[model samples]
Target: MHPFVSVVIPAKNEQGNIGLLIKEISEVLHALGNIQFEVVLVNDGSKDNTVIEAKEFAAQSQCQLQVISHEASCGQSTALHTGIFHAKGEWIVTSDADGQNDPADIPALLQAAQQVQTEHFCIAGFRNKRLDTPWVRLQSKIANGIRQRFLNDGVPDSGCGLKVFPKRTFQALPYFDHMHRFLPALIKRINGKIVVCPVNHRNRAVGQSNYTAWSRAWVGVVDMFGVMWLRKRTKLPRIISEEIE
Candidate 1:
């Protein structure tokens, strides 16, 4: 049977977390035996044993599991796009590899999707109180504020990696570097709805973060303006009356 949901996780040098994360995801999804699901772990050119660990767990996973590798380190957006492109499931869910994103919250996102009764919309997680350093949280807050004001996507925590969306909807979007950070806005550009649900945020217990608040904030500044431009030029027609001749 084909998977109903494809969980795509982007990992870069997350050897310590990949195995545990996969185990947690398997356990959580296995409990929900009614639904068919697959976990796709994208190894974003990690210079560690991440690929090995993932492959080991994939071999023993009860549900379908796939591990995709990149020859060089691409950004998170590219890794996610690679996994999404290869995903066979109708629904796509993404999460971080640092083990901060709880696998238990996946069902809630699924429930939200069912409750809304739409596959074209996105169900994103809102980390009410992030388990990061105070400075990190402050950076996120400022970045989110600026993004919300400019894109008006109405997403409070756009940086949360946990998001549930339809695979087709994601594939339809114009792909670019750092696009992962602006998914809600890009989805909105196509007139897709955004639903934010409060999700658990855990402290990173293992590897150090690949990103820094200063670097992300700086890059985000540039990406935000580009998104604003895309939003301005977007023309999603309210009415379409196309007929084949």
Candidate 2:
């Protein structure tokens, strides 16, 4: 039988962090009990031993686990897209491989998603106490403010890596580079609601940061404008009538 949930992690040169994150996720899910889940780890051309570590964990994991590899480094958006494409679960849970997002919060997201009556919606994690450098936090704050103002996504922290959503809902959205950062906005464009939940955040215990302030500013500006354009051009019908059987 197919799993009920698929947790997708996009790892790029995260050899030190991937294994522990995966193991934590497994333990949390197992403790929750009675929920069949699978872990989909995407190795986005990591130079380190990420693949080896992931494979080793998968071998010993109680729940099903699969690893997908990219020959060259693709952006996070592409890596996530690949993982979603190959996932065989009704619900998709995504988190970064850097261990900043706590695996313990997965149950909260799942519970929120389940308790809501709305079917086509997502539960996104919001880090109340972010564990990042002050400068990085400032940049994120400014960017998030701009995104919320322009896109009206109603999500305060779109940059949060932890989210739980239906697989089909994600499949309906248009794909693009850096699309992961714009999920709340994009999901809103499709007339879907997003529920933001406060989740635990931790400092990265291993590896260095992959993104710098300048690089984030440069690409974030471009992507912000592009997403704004998409939002402006998006048109969803208020109501649809169909023949009843």
Candidate 3:
């Protein structure tokens, strides 16, 4: 049997884009055919009508659509956590709900994950072909370069908004603010082999990003330093004894 795939979307103020995103996923992939899938949308306290439209989409979608809302606006990492927690599918696929991450590219990621026996664990996505503002792209390049130099992890595009992973893998990783940025490296820490493929990136159609360019740059400083701290603090668990607590 094909493993169930959960399509997790993180939305802030994407009222216009959320409905379209759901429709696209249903048409392209998430319709319940040979494989089972679910669309889990985490509305991070959008001031717009995002939640209402998302709920309507859930009512009609062929794939079970679930809407989770945050009482107040939290970061994207929190939204990620909420979606993953609600995901019942064995394989979890996360994408940006701002229309930047194409639903059509999901098949490619799924195929790559399955090829590598992803039932155990794997995070797959694009290494190149990212579409965004020149400044956004440049910022990502500098951030990724710094991460690669410090972490020595060979993730090409860690900032790409599209990723596929086994739900179990997510269960194993430690949670941190902006942890989404270091998914590839975190996966490696738990002995997971992260895979990369080319995924289509589209321009934003609706709401603007919640984060500013300068804040993104500043967060990189904190995140990089924190990651370095984690590297030092990590200790391998030893099998002391098999006694129940």
Error of 2 at 221 (Å): 1.7
lDDT tens per residue, model 2, 109-135: 998888766657889999989988898
Q: Indicate the residue-level lDDT of 19 in model 2.
A: 84
TM-score of each: 0.95, 0.94, 0.90
What residue pairs clash in candidate 3, if any at all? none
**All candidates' lDDT scores?**
0.88, 0.88, 0.80
Off by over 4 Å in 1: 1-3, 240-245
Q: Tell me the lDDT of model 2 at 85.
A: 97
Better of 2 and 3 by TM-score: 2
Expressed as tens digits, the lDDT of each residue in 42-130 for candidate 1 is 98999999988877886677658888999988989999999999987898999999999999999888888876655468999999978
Total clashes for model 1: 0
CA lDDT for candidate 2: 0.88
Off by over 4 Å in 2: 1-3, 238-240
